[model samples]
Target: MEWHNSLAFAQDQDINDEFAAFREEFLFPQNNGKDVIYLCGNSLGLQPKAVVEEITKQLSSWQQLGVEGWFNGSDPWLQYHRKLAAPIANIVGAKDSEVTVMSSLTVNLHLLLVSFYKPAKKKYKILMEGGAFPSDQYAIESQVRFHGFDPEDAIIEVFPPEGEYTLRTEDIVAAIEANADDLALVLFSGINYYTGQFFDIETITQAAHERGIPAGFDLAHAVGNVNLKLHDWNVDFACWCSYKYMNSGPGGISGIFVHEQHHRDSTLNRFAGWWGYKLNERFKMTQGFVPEAGAEGWQVSTSPILLMASLHASLQLFERAGSVAKLRQKADRLTAYLEYLINGINKDLGTEQYKIITPAQQSARGSQLSIICKSNGKKIFDKLLDQGVIGDWREPDVIRLAPVPLYNTFTDVYHAAEIMKEAASATA
Candidate 1:
């Protein structure tokens, strides 16, 4: 699809976009009393207009029912999480029973590690990408120490080759094989947060399984942004947060996917709570920890209905928008337009002033473009914000702009690029 760097072309595209109306369903931040072009969905998505009604419904239930809200409300707090399973399962490409809404991302990571990271005598190491989100690094480090292994020895990090910004799929598979003798588990993020490079989960998972190691992923960046088939990929486990591309509110609920093959594995350990007990037998309060079947069994506490409510609102939109497959159709074009416009900016300047580090292939990335500024990176980013073009700034030099399919329009992309060009010129 050839893209033109003109406002008329962008407006014409928006006129034909079937997903254009979704932009009105979200509330955006204002600058000078007008909606800012919000390209920060990679950080936190714009709130859905339906969120108010969803939360109010739950608040009303709590006000009227008190302790009885658990079982008596219209959408019972007791089974609220069950409503989320089907929708989220659809987003991550898992069966309904294979997924469950639960704790935040890092917390879920720790819970899953307890079950899948079973270290044998010599096979205690975990392999992961270098420069993963700090939360993952800290969690893996502590988990290794808890098992009495030094983190420096027990954690294997696969770094990109010198001067490169992303990992090669073959290199990742090679790392899994090279460490096959000592690796107890292979864990990775579905997309790297900084570079926005989408990993090849299916290939990575297969490599680990062949070596008799379980594979897991933190899908915080990829869950709603890219196409994932966790079930077909034979991933042992995965977790994701709902606040980014899913458009749930800040610090919203996270979810987990545990393959059906792991459902009845009684040998696995869990940090259990009463909520995870067999549903019918739960009220009995009898002793031994009998977990519910499927992914729900990983629950370690009572469900937070408010958070679930927030996510339900957004998932309803996802359902209305059809599958991630459908969403990706629009996302690919929108992202490509942004990339085209940014490249045009560098071309006009006759220099590589803004360098895109994200993968050029649409199949290898999602809706984000990570641009590294040659000079005045922070000032340029600040100018974008002041002008009401809101993308996020990473430390050092990179600026991440995500033109989300659910809300952002092609015109927004055009205006943002125009502002960015102006910012670059002014800063220069």
Candidate 2:
């Protein structure tokens, strides 16, 4: 496709789009009467159009049936989570039996840690990326403390050598190999939420397993944005929220993946509850706990049907879109276009005014591009926002722009770069 630098090019691209029909699937935010260019799906995806209807259906059941909605409603609140598994499993490269829509991101991390990170006296340390999301940092710190261990001694954080904003793959593998003796777990985000670096999960998992350590992932940033093979990769456990990339709305229900090999391993402990008990025996309220044969075994309580409704609405779109493979094809091209435009800004600055801290290779990142403006970062970011170009700003200066394939257009990226160029010039 020859590049045309105008909205006409965007319109032409939209005209040829197979997923263009999905543009109507979400409600874009309005700024001063027009829709803003929302390049922040890596942070919070736009609301699916069917969410209201899906949520309303659940609301109607609750209004008409009251407590009996648990057993007698349209979608039995008791078994609502069952319907959610298959579609999400496809999106994350998981088997239906290996996936469970569950608690929030950090909460799920703690729950998964309870089961997977049972460190012995000699093997007690947990390895993680140093600049992980704060929520993950807090969760890991608390878990190490709960086990009567000092975080400073037991948590091995791998940092990029002095000046780099991203972690090196070789360094990560080295960290696992070096700690092979004391390592009980290797936990990392599938994608770094800030720097937008997608780790080599298969390589990382293989390295950890070689050291006899269980490997798990907090995929909050990677889940719907990139391809994963949690089951095939043989990752011990993983979890993610549905808000970003999954497009399930703000603070929606999350999901977890437990490798099939661990499904019946009773030695793998979890915080079990009645919902996780065998579906047939659940109403029996038996004294002894008999968990369901797969990922369902990790369930702890009644699911929030309303949240599942929101997620179901979004997952339906994914199924129709023929899964993440087709989605990533578009994402790769769109991100490259955004990158092309951002890289072009260097000449306009008379120097390299912005450095792309995100990985240069398409295979090593998702749709996001983290731009570090050499000077006046916040000023440039605010100016972009003021002009109705909505990209997120991380503190200490980085403007995170994501050209989501689902809703972003080529013109959106092109115009966003134009705004950024102007912002830089204004600062000059």
- lDDT top scorer: 1
Give lDDT tens digits, candidate 2, residues 98-205. Answer: 999977888888989999999889899999999999999999989999999999999999998898888988999999999899998999999998899999999999
TM-score of each: 0.99, 0.97
Lowest summed-lDDT stretch of 10 residues in model 2? 1-10
Off by over 4 Å in 2: 1-8
Name the candidate that leads on TM-score. Answer: 1
Indicate the worst ten consecutive residues by lDDT in candidate 1: 1-10
lDDT by residue (tens digit), candidate 1, 86-187: 989899999999999988999999999999999988999999999999999999999999999999999999999999999999999999999899999999
In candidate 1, list every pair of residues with a backbone clash: none
Cα lDDT of model 2 overall?
0.88
TM-score of 2: 0.97
